[model samples]
Target chain A: MLASSSTRPRRVAGFLAKSAPAVISVGLLLVTWELYANHSGIKPTILPAPSRVLEQAILNRGALIDNAIPTIRATLLGFACSLSAAFVFSVLVDFFQPLRRALFPVFIVSQTLPLVAIAPLVVLWFGFGLAPKILLVALVTFFPMLVALVQGYEATEAEIGQMLRAMGAGRWRVFVLARLPSALPYFFAGLRISITYAVVGAIFAEYAGAAKGLGIYMLNAKNNFRPDLVLAAVAVSAVLTLVLFGLTVLLQRIAMPWERVGREPSGKGRRG
Target chain B: MSRLELRHVRKAFGGLDVLADISLSVGAGEFVSILGPSGAGKSTLFQLLTGAEHGAGEMFFDGAPLDDHGRHFAFMPQRDALMPWRRIIDNTTLGLEVQGVGRKAARARVAPLFAEFGLVGFERHFPAQLSGGMRQRAALLRTVVQERDMLLLDEPFGALDALTRAALQRWLEQMWRHHRWTALLITHDVREALYLSDRIYVLSARPARIVREIKVPLPRPRDPTAAAAPLASALEAEILDILLNPQPFKGHDDD
Candidate 1:
């Protein structure tokens, strides 16, 4: 009981340690921006204070959500496309050695061709429709997922697989049972990265061609010198990215619940 | 009355010869162990027995050619080597899943054995969630689920702490008595060898050959304590002889 009581303070301290720094950093940035906007003598339109951004958000919520829908749809669609294709393709590359030999260098080379420069061409081919934007997000998101998954699958415990084989497990069954689950952590890792890429890809494709979206809104607002609205769109984009990334984290927690048993809390480490 | 036989088994990795001219046989329900120091090719022999990698030799399981390892035996590695992604129950049922048994049927088979192995209430936990002995138990359960009468075990208790290792060895002794399965175990622990094995084969250093075979005169269901006294002394003395001064011997010698 004494030991348990003693640990409570330390446990509380540990929890605070991990989370405090990020919260503090974001808090400090908001405080600094608010101070700078109020006292730096900049016009409100050029650099809207945090308060002004909030007011603008309240005023333009409907328009923002309206413009957000198409891009969100494109992002989700592209994410799903990339996920399925990556899953199938990665399995192909892993299972067949000759195919891996033939295709891996080509994949690397494809990634090397700049996505930013490539976005306009995709927009041109698919036309200012949602298809190009979805393609762009898929293109951006596929690599990490593929790489993570393949590496994870390949890293299945060699000894255990042999043991399974001795039990008469065929190659396919061995892979499905052992390789697939082992690759999940890597899949989530890729998903976390690809989630960010999915948002950025959708925005970039939207920037290239779109009837409505935060990207188009920001561009038009910038042209009209509505920097306040542009920044507001940027903020919305950031929040959206965070939400997608957070979903990956939450999924990870669910998929790998065994990892949580002895986890140290992230509460107090960032206090300094 | 299934028996396993090895005839002139030879194995090499590229240019390095790991084992040469090995021959052995185990009758049905026999418990035999290969005892050697580290890197003495005991593990390589186990791997060859399980058809992990092909070696130049004839291996017969139950008088049938063991062309493929999956046919007549089960293998447990030096480590628990459980899949970290799978739950304990799922991991134990891997053999059946590999053999095309449906998950439901496999779980049905595994459910009864969990209580026998002291693995109740923890079926849903992953490999990383289990302790060392528990992991070892899980691996054994997986082997048991295969229901193969012949087992190839390579240092099954090598990684466990001493207390756990002793406990597990006794548990293994009990299980072997209850199951009456044929097991070919490889171990560096002399005490483990004498405690569990009916007959123990000692191998020479690198490029291992059968140096000597010691038969334990102890009775079946031998308690750890009974085996611990004379068996431990004999093992220590023989181990020192194998290491320091192994006088050249071509065949089995009791003196």
Candidate 2:
């Protein structure tokens, strides 16, 4: 009874300590914004208070939900395509030297092209359905995961690879057994980075051209002089990005359960 | 005839010669060790044997030319090198899975050896979860599970603490006594060499060559305390002398 009682307070303290910075900063910022909007006599059309935004979001709950579904679907589908393609391309580049040499520079160059600039052209070609948005999201998010996987493959320990080869394991076996597992941490790191971009990419693609999405809703709200609705939609997108980021972390935890075991301090001495 | 033999195996990296005319042989089921100082090219020779590097050498396995340098040996390096993402059982079965065995079949094959390796109840544990000695044992289990014709161990206990290293050395002896696997070990420790090998080859510092071949006629399952015994002490002193004192190469026994 004593242990349980003491542990509950300790756990709560730990949680509070971890989240204190985010909570304090965000709360302060929102309070300052509320005070400025009220005292400065700013027009609500130009600067809606956080309260007005929250109220508008609640009032338009049905429209918000309808739009959020399509955005979520497009983001997930596009992210999936990006993930599989990155994996396949990474493996091919790892296995084939010529392809890596020929295409690596091109891949980097592809990243340099402002992805948003191309979104409209993609929409022009594919039409303003889900295709262009999915394409844009996949295209924009592919590079980080690909880079992570390739680096991860390279990060494989040379001795481990040699050990595997000495066991009569061929190239594929060495890759599957050693290189692949070594890359998982890097892959997850890449996933975390890409998942955030995935939502932003989806939103940007919608901004270019889309039948319905937060990007379109914000645009419509802006034209109607309803800044509150636009701010509400922006809040929703931020929440969406955060949720996807958390899911990526959860996936990593599940995929690499061994990583939960903290590494023991290696004992050191003269090598025999 | 020896089960494996190397004749005039030579390797040089640019201006530095790592191995110069080193030749050795090991009979079937014999435990042989190569002893040398750090950076004496002991590991280089193993790398060459593993086909990770190419060198001018002739290696024979079972009296046939060893064209396929790696197919006959299971190698265990200094570090455990366990995959951090895999469970202990899966890590141990890596070799079998590489050889095209189904994952389930490979797991079943190595599951019985976990207990023998002192890894009972750790079949589901990760390498990070195990102590240093346990990880090393798991590495050894990974090596032996292959059932290759020979085992190449590069300072298998080199990374552990003194107590853990001693415990593992004793455990290895007991395991080897029962299995009688043909093995070659590379190490720098004089006592470790004296305790484990049927024969020990002393190699010279860089541009390493076999300086002397000493036979260890000590009985099986030798005690770690036996280093204090006269015969073992004398052998240890002699090996240490050879390692510490550098003699000018006279080419007295080239072959």
Candidate 3:
């Protein structure tokens, strides 16, 4: 018990040591921005001081949070839809060779179309509501996940597949027992890449047209010459991305404890 | 009764014949080793047995013709082939799971054998966390857990270090002695063939046919050391001669 308790602080120390560089760099960037804004004496409409931005953020927290709800809702709903759709699409592509040959090229072509170019069209079709924002988020997040899942499925060790088949595992069983589990790490990697885009995609959708959201709020703030409020919304977006990324990392930790344990030094000498 | 029989079996990849008129058998509860040089269709033989490759001729198990090659025998490939994502116990139970056994029941059944297989305390560990030997043991356990009539082992210890290989060989012999599962091992190691097999079949180069078959008269748990067993040395030398200088065909005329 004593040993276990002692190791907890040591683990915390290790974590801090590992994270110190990133924290320090971000702190320095914030300090530089604050110093520059304070000394330049620019008009607040054009370039607000960091303190002014913080003060505006505190004063308008209620309005900002109300707008944030719809944005968060759209992101989560869209992400969930993309996750399931990507899984199904990846499985189909993996199972059917002709479909892969036909649809994979189309998927690549779709990705080449810029989200900015497509967002307005989606909003025009789906209207200025949650539907358009969710559609845009799903479009932006689907492809990376599908590609990663396909790569993961293909990367399953051939020998293991053969072994499973010899043991009487059918095609679906082989996929579930071997392919699906192997694809998880890649799936999570794709999730991490695509999740950061989800909020931004929702915001772009909202910028095109929306009843209320952080994107519309920012547009109103910009038109009213409240640069501080616009910047505050941007900060909230960054925090949202960080929180989602942290959640993905946490999910990975819970789902794959083996990967973490494998990397630790076991201290046991090699056994013959 | 013979557990397995390959009667005049033949296989060809397109026009390139890999196994020409290969015939062999393993009696019930016996250990047989097939020794061959690389590219001698040793793996092809396993592919045929596992229904991965189609071949012409009869394959019988326990006096009945095998309608399907896959269901009758469990197979271990050259590599450990344990799923990296699964815990050791889960990986070992994969065969049973695929055979329609419930996961909990399969785990319950396999849990007791971990100690016997030298995999104690690793039931919850991943494949990457174990050493090479442990992975192979877990793989072997996976193969055996299916409770099939026979096992097809394709150089299961080929990738291990020399010490680990020897140790696993002893462990395998002990397991086989206890369970008496009919097993066919494919290897090019002459000493390994002599030490573990009740009989050995040596195959020639490409378009492999059984060039020689030697029955081991040595007793159980045969000593592998050169000083302890003269008969093993003699058998090893005989098998080595056959492998080095394969005799030309005597009766068959087709080249």
Candidate 4:
């Protein structure tokens, strides 16, 4: 209890230390925008003041939330599907040499097609429904995860693999016990990058064509000359990205507690 | 009967000979050391014995020709090679787990030995959490938990500092006394070989062949600090002489 109590203040201090710069910068950005629009007499349609954006967000809370539900759902479903498919593809490629040779180049080529160019095509092919949005998110997020996982699998410590093989472990058993666990850090790294892309991808897909989503809401606001509402939708998308990134970090911590334990001061001698 | 016997083992990598007509045997419950120079293929010999490399050899265990080398010997390479992600208990039981034993049963089997191996409270700790000595002990525990008939240890303490190495050498002697698993250690430290083994084989440089075999006549619980022990000094000097002067030593070759 004493240790826990003592650590609480330290935890707060650590959080402040990490977040202070970002908070200050964002605060400065808002203050500058508010002064420029309010004092300089810029029309709200061209540059909405911070207060105007906040007020408009408050007024449109119900619509914003209603649009957010579909966007969040699409992002999550796309991310989940991408993760599973990437894992299966990576494992298959790792297992079979011919498949890796055949599929790796294709994966690289697929990533080169600009998302802006493909978003419209995906909407046209899948229709302006949830399918296009989810597919767009999956396409944008899949490559990073696949590349990270394959690298992780290939990076299994040679000596450890040899040791397991000498112990009569089969190939699959070696992959499961040694390679899979070794790949986790890389996997999480990929997840952090791809998770941010997931939300943005869904928004882009919605912008191309969608029945309901934050992207559609923002598009309507823009057409109606409501800059404050568009800015409010942007804020929602930023919040969603932050939430997803934070969730990935939390999941990583929970999944690999041993990694954290090893780094703590256990009051022992130097590890090496 | 000897627990393991290697008769005229010959291994070649490409066109280069690594081990040529090497032969040795370890009696049941005996500890033997193979001492050689850095490039003398000591590790290659182990690779051959463990079936990581195919070589022309006749390997026998308990008077029977050994078919599956992996089933009969537990091996520890020079590095600790502990999986960083696995906790100590899981790493210790890795061999048993690979052999199809359930994780819980494997953990139970190794739990009692943790204290004896100086890893009592570190069962749940990861490899990076422990000190170098602790990691090595955990690795040795991993090997011992396999319950194999013999152990092939290649320079297990070579990477440790002088103090830690000496301490672990003593601990290893104690563990060997208690467990009595036939062990074959490959090392370049003459003192380590003399201090631990009942018999020592001195190998030549490249294309390693046994140059000499000396018996350690010292009694059990031998004192490593007994620099004056006549037999230990004599064996050490003889091995050093053979290592330093390789040309004349070929006269002693039985092959």
Candidate 5:
């Protein structure tokens, strides 16, 4: 009876502990900003304090909301394009070795070219609306996804593959049963990196030139010398990134509940 | 009639030969054990039989070559090899599921064996959740669930603790009698070989060939006899001889 009673509360406590890192991080940054504003004696227009920023955020919630919608839409659209493209390319690389061999070097070389250098080119080719940002996000995200998939797929044991073959399992069955299941964790790991890349990449492209998005807002605030506004836009971007990445985590939770149960014992972290 | 015949079988890895002109026959419904020391190529022979690799020479199942009528037998490895993600029942149903049985139908077939093997309440439990002995039992169930006439076990209990190993061996003896299967077991344990087999084939180290064939006539449920009396001493002595002096009967290059 005692054991059963404590379980729910323990679970709640455990959840709070897992979330501690993100909370502490955002909290410490907020505190630092408040202190810096207090000590600097800067004018509110140039660099507003956290309290002033919050008041402006509240007062301009209408404006912030109007801009946030377009930015969120672009990020999601770009992320979707990036994911679908990476998945197809990864499958292609896995299926055809010669293609992978030829393209892998090209991909490495592509990464060496700065996004700043390439974003304008992508924007010029695809135009300003949504296509260029989506294309940029896909370019940034695809490499890590492809590399991760190949590594995960390659790590499947030859012995297990042979065992499946001996069972009279077909090639597809061997892949689905052994290789696919083993690669799931690695796939999720790649997805986390891809999601962050998607948002950050989209924003970077927007900074190069976009009519809308938080990147443009940051650029406007920086030009006007409103550090608080820049910081506010940054805060919104961080939260947006967190939401996208958190959604990936939640998807993984639903997809692979067995992972959490098998991996860590209760109360193992140093959160307290 | 012989259920299996390894006819003049030869296997080589590049310059090194693993099985040299080996030949053996197993009678239908016979409980045969292949007993040999470690690195005796016993596992390699089993792998050949199971088609883990293609090799020279004919491996006939019931008069037909294995190439002609495959998928009629099941092979259980030394390790459980259960997928960590799958539940015990799911693991048990793997072979049938692989054979195109629906999940519901396959799981239904395995529902009966759970009670018999003390796995009744643990159907939903994953392989990681089960003990070593339980995992082996689960792996064995996967093989048997296929309605296979012949079962090839490769040291299925080699990883278990002594007490659990002995208990499971007795359980296996019962299971074999209750449900007759032409079984070929590979084990290095002489007592286990003597306890479980109708006949035991002792093989020489690398490029393994049969050095001795010991026939155990100790009768049904031999675990009792194996545990007590002169029977234990005799089996121990026979196994000890191979361990103490293995030079004269050495076969081919050491594995």
Candidate 6:
């Protein structure tokens, strides 16, 4: 306990040191942008100064928060639906080879169909409401998770399945015992990718049409020649994406606690 | 009556014959081994017994046709197939759980064997947290806890290094002596067979047929140091020669 406590600060310092380069680079870029916007003789409408964007963000914080609430709700709702739909579909594909062969290629083709193009149509069909935004987000996010789950299920060692079967396990038992657990890491990997897109997906759907959201706010701000507000909205959306991504990583750790335990340098160098 | 018997078991994958006219038997509580070179279809024999693969065969378990596949045997593969997600205790209880035993009951049943299997204090630890030898022991514990009629072990210790393999072999020998479970082991290691089994059936390469059956001329709970002794080394050399020299496949004989 004493040794670990002593090293705690050092470990934290190590982490900060490792991330220092990224932090420094981003800081430098922001500084350069701030200086350029102030002195480049460009109109504030085209590209507002960082200070103006921050000032607008603080001034219009109420509007930003209100608009953000709707977008956040749609993102969370859509992603939950996407996650369940992906899991159920992946299990079906894993169980039925014929279904996998028939549907997997179609799903792959569907991913390439440009969610941007489809968002307008979805909004047209469902109208300017929360439903279209949720549907659009679910559509855009479900495929990565589906592909991850399918591949993860396939990644189980054949001998493990054979061993399970020899123990009187039937098809469902084998799946529960071997395939599902093996797919967890892959599931999380797919989840991380999907989540990074969730807020962006929700925003894009709102861009096509929406009653109220960050995307709608940005659209209004852009039309009204308020680039500072537009930039503030982009910042808010980026922050939302980061929060969701972080949540996914946390969820992964909680779900698969064994992985963390495995990485702790076991004094016994044994792997079978 | 023998606990398990296979008569005229033959398997051919597509056009290639794997196990050609194989027959063997393990009497009650007897430890038997199928010794052969790699790709000698040694595993195919176990596969046949487990009904994982179908072939022309008559399998009898206790004077009856062995039709119920799951009831008769517990199988251990080359690698310790413990799910990385499950705790060591959970892994050991997996077979029992599959047999319709409740998790709580299964845990209660296997709780005592953890100490015996050298897995004490690792009940909650995952497979990855333990050493390779411990993991294999946990795998064996999983198989043994099921309390099946026999164990079909396909190169159970083949993946371990020489030192760990030797240690596990000695441990397994002691376990077998105590439990007297009927076990059929497949391996290319001559010494492993000589050390462990009451009888060893040597098989010819591919289209495998039983080339010879030798009764182990050693006593129970055999000393590992005795492996270097004249009698054991001589038998080992003889088995190695038989494995190295491929005899032509003669036509099937009706015994």
Best by TM-score: 6
- Each prediction's DockQ against the real complex: 0.37, 0.43, 0.58, 0.65, 0.27, 0.71
Q: Model-by-model lDDT, in order?
A: 0.83, 0.89, 0.88, 0.90, 0.78, 0.90
* Candidate 5 CAPRI classification by DockQ: acceptable
Residues A177-208, model 3: lDDT tens digits: 88988888898899899999898988988888
**Native contacts kept (model 5):** 0.14
True interface contacts reproduced, per candidate: 0.51, 0.54, 0.61, 0.65, 0.14, 0.76
Residues A1-272 of candidate 2: C-alpha lDDT, one tens digit per residue: 88669778887999899999999999999999999998999999999999999999999999998888888988999999999999999999999979988988988888898976798899899997888888988988898989999999999998888888887778988898789989999999999999988998898888887889988888888899999999999999999999889888899888887775544332422122
Clashing pairs in 3: none
Clash pairs (backbone) in predicted model 2 = A272-B188
Q: What are the root-mean-square deviations of the candidates from the true structure over C-alphas? A: 4.8, 3.4, 2.5, 2.3, 4.2, 1.8
> In model 5, which runs have C-alpha deviations exceeding 4 angstroms?
A1-6, A17-29, A42-48, A95-98, A157-160, A263-272, B224-229, B248-255
- For model 6, residues A160-210, the per-residue Cα lDDT tens digits are 999998988999999988999999999999988998788889999999998
lDDT for residue A137 in candidate 3, whole number 0-100 = 89
TM-score of every candidate? 0.90, 0.91, 0.93, 0.93, 0.89, 0.96
Off by over 4 Å in 1: A1-18, A261-272, B226-228, B244-255
Q: Candidate 1 docking: what grade? A: acceptable
Better of 3 and 6 by DockQ: 6
The best candidate in terms of DockQ: 6
Task: Summarize candidate 6's per-residue lDDT along B49-168 as a digit string, tens digits.
Answer: 887899997888998998889999999998998899999999999999999999899999999998899889999998889988999999999998899999989999998988989999
Residue B234 deviation, candidate 5, in Å?
2.7
Tell me the tens digit of each residue's lDDT in model 5 across B1-255. Answer: 889888778788786877766677778778999888888778788778867666788788878888733376787877777876677888788788778899999989999988888787889876666677777788888888788768889898998889879878989999988887899999999888888888887777777777666777787866556646586667668766865567675443311
On the 0 to 100 scale, the lDDT of residue B147 in model 4 is 93
Q: Candidate 1 at residue B247, lDDT?
A: 63
Error of 2 at B94 (Å): 2.2
Looking at candidate 5 chain B, the ten consecutive residues that score lowest on lDDT are B246-255
* Minimal lDDT window, size 10, model 6 chain B: B246-255
Weakest ten-residue segment in model 2 chain A by summed lDDT: A263-272
